[model samples]
Target: MSEITPADFALFLLASGDMQPRKRARDQQADLAGLELKRHVLDLIVSYAPPADALEATLMQIAQEIGPPYGPTRALCASIRDEFADAASTPGFMEWLIEEAVRENAGQKEKRRGKTFNQ
Candidate 1:
């Protein structure tokens, strides 16, 4: 393989978030089943977040890797969600809005690409 630049590494870290570290810290004991579940959860979220909801995809992936309900990343996501919820009167409905936005954008992108799904 070719040498990876710091810029490339930074982008990968930004994209992968906690997954790299967690996978590396316990390669032998890492929960493969849990990770599989996490990926399923992420894909589910992505299915919901069509186009502009790319941010939500990033959120779900990062949250899952940050490790379940007790990890710092999970807590951070919760806090962010709580704050976002407080911004509205109907409580934490940001997820739904995100999904709708995703669907709308995804529809547009699909039409442009002349294909369905993550082209």
Candidate 2:
């Protein structure tokens, strides 16, 4: 099997929001790979996010806050987590994240209201 680069792994971690300020910079060397960082971060949030089940509940609450589509994704989770299932911290949270991504994309296609038509 081809080894994954630390840069790539860190990119994936950043994508998932699992990265710490120092750790991100430390992953520059292409040697420290093989570990999934995103799931690690998600687990941290799930276990330590103050109030049990905060991620799941926050997702829904933010969905309501952002007000549909855009609400849940950014308003709720901030970024989408691909491996929510393997996260082991909270189950099914990734589903909500992806579902919101789809919804948010759909919502973006609708266009915002503010353009005055030129005669």
Candidate 3:
């Protein structure tokens, strides 16, 4: 698996919480499922490859802004930052994350397609 860069982590963090307005009921369900999956993926990443102090602080700040209900907390962010070595040590974990991300993006694109008729 390719290395997981800081930018990748940040982008995933940002994208995972994105919520679009005016979604249909089915779309909302899919969005929720996607969000949950992303969150779980984040948790896995944290568990394996904790963040550095600066990155951890940034994550905490973001999480604070994201806040309660469905959002991750500063404590949760810290927890992940403190435990990254596990991810780094695990075989195939990084590959799995990249695959999951690609799949998620493809699913999102499919969801965004408009109806069409063959001529």
Candidate 4:
């Protein structure tokens, strides 16, 4: 199984609202169990109601720890941090996130296929 990274966690958070249904969808199937564990950890932090800056710091720390291929870049982490709250409160934000994740995943899969074929 592929290791989940901070980017995956952030994507999970952004799409969490529809996770259950997405998990059941064939094309959307992913390591939901692993993502759930990450979600639980995030929930623990959120329960403390950390200030925005602190929350962003914590997220950046996670990204650094998970650095590289799957890990998000500092810019991506900042974007995710800035958008996290709106993802929960803004209508349709979750849908947009899910769609973006799917699109990105599809593109990555295609790249992998190309690499394999070329090799």
* Top-lDDT candidate index: 4
lDDT of 2 by residue, 1-119 (tens): 23322233223344432232335545554323213333433444543443433445544554454353453244224442223324334455444544555565555455442232322
Residue-wise lDDT of candidate 3 within 36-59, one digit each (tens)?
A: 644754654454344443565556
List the candidates' TM-scores in order: 0.25, 0.25, 0.46, 0.39
Our model 3 lands, by Cα RMSD against the true structure, at 7.7
Our model 2 lands, by Cα RMSD against the true structure, at 18.7
The better-scoring model by TM-score among 2 and 4 is 4
Instruction: Arrange candidates, best lDDT first.
Output: 4, 3, 1, 2
- Judge candidate 3 against the unseen true structure and give its global Cα lDDT, from 0 to 1: 0.53
Error of 4 at 78 (Å): 7.6
* Candidate 3 wrong stretches, greater than 4 Å: 1-3, 13-53, 60-72, 82-84, 114-119
Candidate 1 has an lDDT of 0.44
Worst 10 residues of 2 by lDDT: 1-10
lDDT per residue as tens, model 4, 49-93: 455546677766655655664333455456556566665467776
Q: What 10-residue stretch in candidate 3 is worst by lDDT?
A: 13-22
Q: Which residue runs does candidate 1 get wrong by more than 4 Å? A: 1-14, 21-30, 50-119
Shift in Å, residue 97, candidate 4: 0.6
